[model samples]
Target: MSDFTQRFLFDDFDARGELVTLEGSYRHVLAKHPYPEPVAQLLGELLGAAALLIGTVKFDGLLVLQARSTGAVPLLMVECSSAGELRGIARYHAEQIGDAQSLGELMPNGDLAITIDPANGQRYQGIVALDGANLADCLSTYFATSEQLPTRFWLFADGQRACGLLLQQLPVDRQKDPEARAASWEHVVTLADTLTAEELLSLDSETLLYRLYHEEAVRLFEPRALQFRCSCSRERSARALVSLGREDADQLLAEQGGTVVIDCQFCNQRYPFDAADIAQLFAGGGVEPASDTRH
Candidate 1:
């Protein structure tokens, strides 16, 4: 199935939920880098988590989820835009990774960070220690500690696909009956906890929700498409070189035989700057190469 995120509201509960399944997008991220099995699985989970978290807010830019540690896997990060474009990368010691399966094992003393960068406003970031057994638990701790919200997550990823479910308790309003709302929240979460990883990965949103909340008043929103897209371009790459200052750029070009190469880690796309390209960039002109050369 295509990658998509489905939002839902509980008519009987003061809560919200999101279900996301990523197949094509997940595979696209894996294709860009040959991540080891453990790293690939972790990247997939982060990708799903980023997408689900972005849907929780109304923003116009990018949401980034990052984890850093002093372990086999030093860093793993994923970014999802408001428009559903996604990209991710992971850095790890291949031999040190071994057969570790949980977040604690992969990142011994790690910290999780979530950042929201809007197009026209200040960025917001929150950090939490990675004290949970798995990624889902780590994120749950983030929500409880950072947002002060009762949030739960079920995340699963193999090398092939990634899937996630997010459940959050909505803010209480004076008009609503507090006891009723609290009861409903508990009911929904209890049912959600029964979901198995296999069912989450294989079932569609509609079927999955029905199977879990068939008796409840659950309203599922239309699925939004999620895609694998890199925001990298020759222009952006050229601008980066210009920022290094004219003299440094020229020296680098000379050292590399009049050609400077920049590779995007997210998409594995290479941008080569020859003398003409470098000259145009330094002259405050656009990069208009004769042919598109990508490696």
Candidate 2:
């Protein structure tokens, strides 16, 4: 099935949810990096989480989920645009990653940061300690602590595909009994917890929702397409070089035999700059003329 995210509301309860399954886009991300099995699985989970979280907010730029630690896996990050394009990368010490399965084992002393950057506005960020056994648990902790909302997440991934389900309780209406709203939230979350990883990866959204909430009044929205796309470009790379300043850029060119090479970690695309290119960039001439060769 095509990669997509489905949003659903519980008509009879004060809650909302999102389900995301990523196949083609997930595979495309894996194709760009040779991550170890454990690391690959973690990246997949983050990718799914990024998609679900991005769908829950309104922004025109990018949403980034990052985990940093001092354990075997030092850093794992995923970026998703408002347009549904996704990309991810993980950094780890291969020797230290042998067979580590849980979040604590893979990223001990870690912290998770979620950043929301709009195309035109101030960025917002929330940082939470990685205090749970898994990525899903850590994320749930984030919502509960930062947003003061009861939220839960089920995330699973193999090297091939990634899937996630997010459930959050909406604000209770003043006229409604608070006890009843709390009960409804607990009931639905209990049902969602019974979902197996196999079913999440294999079942479509409609069938999956029916299997979990067949008795409840649920409304499912149209699926939003998710794609694998990297925001990296020749122009962005040039700006990076320009940031290095004229002296540093010239020194790098001299050290690398008159051509500086920069490779994007997200896509492995190479951007090469010679003396002419560096001069043009430092001269304030935006990214080498269109005629400039790009690889």
Judging by lDDT against the true structure, name the best candidate.
2
Query: Model 2, residue 76: what's the lDDT?
Result: 93
Error of 1 at 84 (Å): 0.4
The candidate maximizing TM-score is 2
lDDT tens digits, residue span 178-201, model 2? 888888988999999999999999
lDDT of 1 by residue, 272-292 (tens): 988777777777678877335
Off by over 4 Å in 1: 173-175, 290-295
TM-scores for every candidate against the unseen true structure: 0.94, 0.96
- What are the clashing pairs of model 1? none
The lowest-lDDT stretch of 10 consecutive residues in candidate 2 is 286-295
TM-score of candidate 2 versus the correct structure, residues matched by position: 0.96
Supply candidate 2's per-residue lDDT for 43: 93
Q: Against the unseen true structure, what C-alpha lDDT does each candidate score?
A: 0.89, 0.90
List all candidate RMSDs to the true structure: 2.0, 1.6
lDDT of 2 at 8: 99
